[model samples]
Target: MANLQLKAIKKSYDNVNVIHGIDLEIKDGEFVVFVGPSGCGKSTLLRMIAGLEEITQGHLLVDGVDMTHQPATERGIAMVFQSYALYPNMTVRGNLSYPLEVSKRPKAEIKQRVELTAQKLHLNELLDRMPRALSGGQRQRVAIGRAIIREPRIFLFDEPLSNLDAELRLEMRIEIAKLHESLGNTMIYVTHDQLEAMTLADRMVVLRQGVIEQVGAPLALYHNPDNMFVAGFIGSPRINFMAADVVATTVGQVQLRIEELAIDSLIMTVQQRLNEGEKVWLGVRPEHFVSADGADCHFSSTLTFAEHLGHTNYLYVDYDQEKTLVIEQRELEKHTNGDSVTFGINAQQSLLFAQSGERIR
Candidate 1:
């Protein structure tokens, strides 16, 4: 196990910059996930950590030793890519043992490590099967087993479950989680799927446009985002943004006038005082909306769409000409398009953001 330190890490292509200056510290044996949308440079950053991509600037330290210029082999890191990358002709055992063989380890040791990896990944029954003969999940297991046999200090995964079906992705996700628990290795995973990141990461690094936006525990980032980008990116169904004008401000409270929903004035406590007449956004999550009965605040709108997923229901309402509000309901409600629906907003749970997308305390 090893800890990593990235200080002013950066990457560029010719004159164009991709990864901006980033500074982060990953603890030993911690599972950290790098997550972002496409073109966010999450994969590029992971490749840099694995020594696959060269760093254009800054220092990378592994366990207090500089490894920025080290070769992949000397970095003591094993990587698993989105593609299986398994040899078509090699059997599972051969694939698992090839790395040790190339390093010229003892024959008995290689055989023993291969067996242990296979057993750990539950690939013991598929040891003799070729990559083509195995199922996709099995192939991924073989790929993981191949990496496990190396017993590197750090493990890097670049969207390893992207190729699998939903069920297989879930299966492999659980398998990977279990593997991390058992081995207690330092792991860095990159993915565009926030659900995967949320489930697998001990802490998540949310990226955007080659910049590190926020890094924290999954729920911390979800519940207490640093800005609008993070608050919008981290949650499912997205957070609702409505225009609100600061009608008044006091020691620890701000009175908001939400003209969009025809609300005259509503008061909520805040960490900082806001200037009166300043325009801000009120953000409410879909799950934060409750039934209108006995609610602190409420709004009425016409339902535009509805999605029922048995355990939970999502109601989409037309907020304005440019936006739609998604509300989550625990109890299933039968509603058709264009029907009038009322939702209760929990003011205490809501968030406020400046016009520039920065969170306002």
Candidate 2:
């Protein structure tokens, strides 16, 4: 296992900068994920670490050795791409041993490595089968096995599960997680899927257009996002944001106007400085909403739609100003398209963001 470090790394195409100076230190054997929307530079950053893309500036170090200018073959890294990229005519054994063979390992060593990788990946029974004969998941396994046979110090996966079906993706995700545990190598995975990053990463780096938005453990980022962008991006069914004007401010709490709702006063603890009459956004997660009366704030609205998902339902409600809010409820009773419903939330769980989208607390 090896630690990877990137210092002031950058990339550009014809002087149009894509990756703005990024610095990170990845501990040995740590599973780090780079997650963000497309065109956010996650993939470009991964490729730079893999030595596939030339660094426009700054340095990259692996195992404490500078490798910024090294060739991909000398980086001691293996990558599994979204496409399996397997050779059509090559058998599974051939595909797995190809890298070792090119490295000029002894014939016996190549055979042994291939056999071991096939066994680890459970591809022993399909060793002689061509790529065309294997299913999508099996082909993906072969791609991974090829990487494993290389005995790389670090592993890089770039959306390796994107091409698979949903069920297959889940199965492969578990398999990859188990593989990491068994191998204990430094692995960096890049994906746009938040759930995958949340479940697979020991730590995650969230990026926005050529910039790092936040870095933290999955639950940390989910519970306490550094800014509004991260707060909205990291969760499923996203957090709801409402426009409000600060009505009152104290050392520990502030009151806000929730529009025309009869119960509009919402008090939230503030960790940052804010004066009265300042406009701010109120953020509340779908699950933080409660149907009972014991809440810090309460509001009534007309239900516009409800989606039943077996155990729970997502209710979309609209107020008079056309602002829509989503609420999650269990055992939802007597709710329809035009029925009025009241939802409440605890003030401590609510998030406040300034006009700049920076979290106030």
* lDDT, candidate 2, 227-311, per-residue tens: 9999999999999988888889899888888775665578888877789989988889998999658998788888899998888
- Candidate 2, lDDT over the whole model: 0.91
Model 2 TM-score on a 0 to 1 scale: 0.97
Mark the regions of model 1 whose C-alpha exceeds 4 Å error after superposition: none
Estimate, for each residue in 1-361, the C-alpha lDDT of model 1 and write its tens digit.
9999999999999999999998999999999999888999999999998899999999999999999999999999999988989999889899999999999999999989998888888888999998999998999989888888899999999999999999999989999999999999999999888889999999999999999999999999999999999999999989988899999889998888888777756788888768999999999999998888867778899999999999898999987677888999898768899999988876778999999999998
| Ten-residue stretch with the least lDDT total in model 2 | 258-267
Candidate 1 pairs with clashing backbones: none
